[model samples]
Target: MSLISTSSPSSKTLPILRGQHLHLWFDHEKTKALDDMNYAISENEFVAITGPSGCGKSSLLNLLGTLEIPTGGTLFFRNQNYHDIQDLALFRRQHIGFIFQSFHLIPTLSALDNILVPTLGNSQQKKDVTERALDLLNMLNLGGRSNHFPSQLSGGERQRVAIARALINQPDILLADEPTGSLDSINAQQVLDILCEIKQQQSLTIVMVTHDPAVALRADREVRMRDGKALDMTQVLT
Candidate 1:
């Protein structure tokens, strides 16, 4: 799993996302979660951010996911200033897929229903989302569990359903915050393999936060952090 390769560029190059000396403060005056983080994520690359707990890895992920805006510095997506974008919901729906460590599935919703949740209240997506959701369930090997609710499934199965939910929108990038952190060894490996397969099949750019060295080694590039800062710029994959 130590094998590493620079992401070979395609005939056409696209600037997917970039962060310039970013900063994030949980509390504007007291707590600073992220400090001076600068990184670039290329098209169709799998990049893992690894570090000790509370080192701002998740905060960095949140900023990249566009779920939280940085306190300072510039963030760009598709060459446009993301902080200035007026409609984040539309932007996220078009380009980003997010998976959290908690699984975050509604207790009352069935696996299929959970996966289709993002497509609701929208005429274009709601029109043909059933088939898409079903396909994702099948892809994640949860086809038989479609009718099962969160309480009825194992931790691994629930995470897989969450993954299906993230992918239901056919997003360009998938952001995962410690995706396999809650699973057993066998289940973790299964989830890792599925992520790799889907990344290749869908040509996705994945930015994942992981504490597991084995999991970090599987990524095309690894960025290490400490004390809410990126350790070095040269350590990143270009």
Candidate 2:
């Protein structure tokens, strides 16, 4: 199992997420999708990963999300070595939140229920979970839409529900892949604003992948990738 010991503030100043010489290959492939990539993301930092379609940006996110393990190297969350963790599912459930471009909400559930989905595994009181979900939905400006189903909401509203669902678990890190891809420009900007606000209000550490330069420009740090390698291209905000 992964080590769960608490360290001093000195160590807390260390990266909240770090990849040590990460490498990945898919199913006996001749080429590696991620070639010995190394990255360190600090607590509460907003980072963006950008690249062409095949540049391994999503692979990097998968590795960081613990959905995929590296063929070589190690990924650490706080002080824990993820590959050493025995109960990965529980570990992830407790710590990581994900937002996908597709808005993966349950089709039959109302927006509020979709937001409450993650809390089903938790032992918190129902009132507490409902309160948390309501707070997030209201903050995302979807309070009036809570009773609606996924099909009844607009694209942006659906994505807001998806974002609320991700936050229900109160995760330490949020991973988003093209979160605004399907929205109109106004909706995209609205989603981006909400993301920034949440990061600031909750002190969240976010790692988002985007093809849009506009989205990349919104991050505190932008990392660009090409041919399975990433490089720090710009620091737009901090």
Candidate 3:
């Protein structure tokens, strides 16, 4: 691991996402989820945010995903400031995809339907979205499980569906919070392999939050957090 400061400039390409002196507080400034955090993620880079519980890893991920706004400081997507984006939901739909540890699939919906959930109010035609969903399922090796419900599928299978769903929208950034946290080692490795392949094939930028150092090692860089701030950012030598 090559240690680097959070404020260091990237020599390769401009950051797809960047944060400076970010702060997120709750309950009238009582809970500071993010305190003076600074970070940057280059395009097509796979970066991991790792830390102990309540260290604000997920909170930072949420801010990057545009699911939550910061209380202070600045966040930028390329040259665009986050605060300048008026419609956060539309911005997310166009630029971000999310995966969670729990799968978060609807028990009543089939795998394919669940995958199509993100496309549900979009202007795209139903046929097009369905075709894309099927393609994603096939890519994740879950084509045969398209009709399987969350309850009917194994944990790994359900997670695969969630992965497919995240890619269905063709977002520029994939924000994953503990995507493999609930799986066994074998399944976790499988999921990481798929993500790697996806990144190569699609040139996707992945920002993942994980507690496992092994998983963090798989990323191009790791941003370790503590006390709601980035302690350091390190480039992983492959």
Candidate 4:
């Protein structure tokens, strides 16, 4: 785990995340999953990474989300090299939140407990954090389903629980990997709408990887990838 401070990001800050000449390898076979990928994301900007399957979108997301360090080059957060940080888990817990297509919730835990999981063992007051968890569940339209287990909830409801869990620590950045891939069209659209709403209200930067063009189009900018390198980047609405 890497060391992290619980400081909030200011609006005037430039480039919340930057990666230059990044590379990643696996096994002794030297399979370069990420090859010289470079990109930057500004504060509160909604950016999407889109490409064919196995094009390294998830790999890039992992780097940006601080789940893994680059094999080469550097990754900077708020102009600071993240490599220098020693407690990566602390960094993730304090600054980065992740959402996956699978919704990764525990089947036995109630929706509220799942949301409150991340807030445990931290310095925040338990009662207050529990209240916030309930609020988040309600905000995501799961107010009446707090006691429901993941098995009992619908696909959309489970994903909403995952979102609430991710936001429990009030992270500065949200990293999502094919967040809508497993859902039907209607539920996917609903999830995207909720994401946009959260971004506007919280002013948090979001970097998402999506195979669906419609989902990618919702971002402020899209970076296209091929052969593990970014290319033909374009702005969507800015």
Best lDDT goes to which candidate? 3
Off by over 4 Å in 3: 1-12, 233-238
TM-score of each: 0.92, 0.92, 0.92, 0.92
| Candidate 2: Cα lDDT at 193 | 94
130: Cα error in model 1, Å: 0.6
Residue pairs with backbone atoms closer than 3 Å in model 1 (clashes): none
Candidate 4, superposed: residue stretches over 4 Å from native: 1-13, 233-238
Model 1 lDDT at residue 74:
95
lDDT tens digits, residue span 1-238, model 2? 7686565557558788988778888869677898878787888999989989988988999988889888888888987888789987788788889999999999999999999988887889999999989998888888898899999999999999999999899899999999999999999999999989989998899999999999989998888888777754233212
For candidate 2, the 10 contiguous residues with the lowest summed lDDT are: 229-238
User: Model 1 off-target regions past 4 Å?
Assistant: 1-12, 125-127
List model 3 lDDT by residue over 119-232, tens digit each: 986999999999999999998899899999999999999899999989888998999999999999999999999999999999899999998999999998888889999886
Compared with the true structure, all predictions reach lDDT values of: 0.87, 0.87, 0.90, 0.87
As a TM-score, model 4 comes out at 0.92
lDDT of 1 by residue, 119-237 (tens): 77456756479888888889899989999999999999999999998998889899999999999989989998999999999999999999999999999989999988878888653
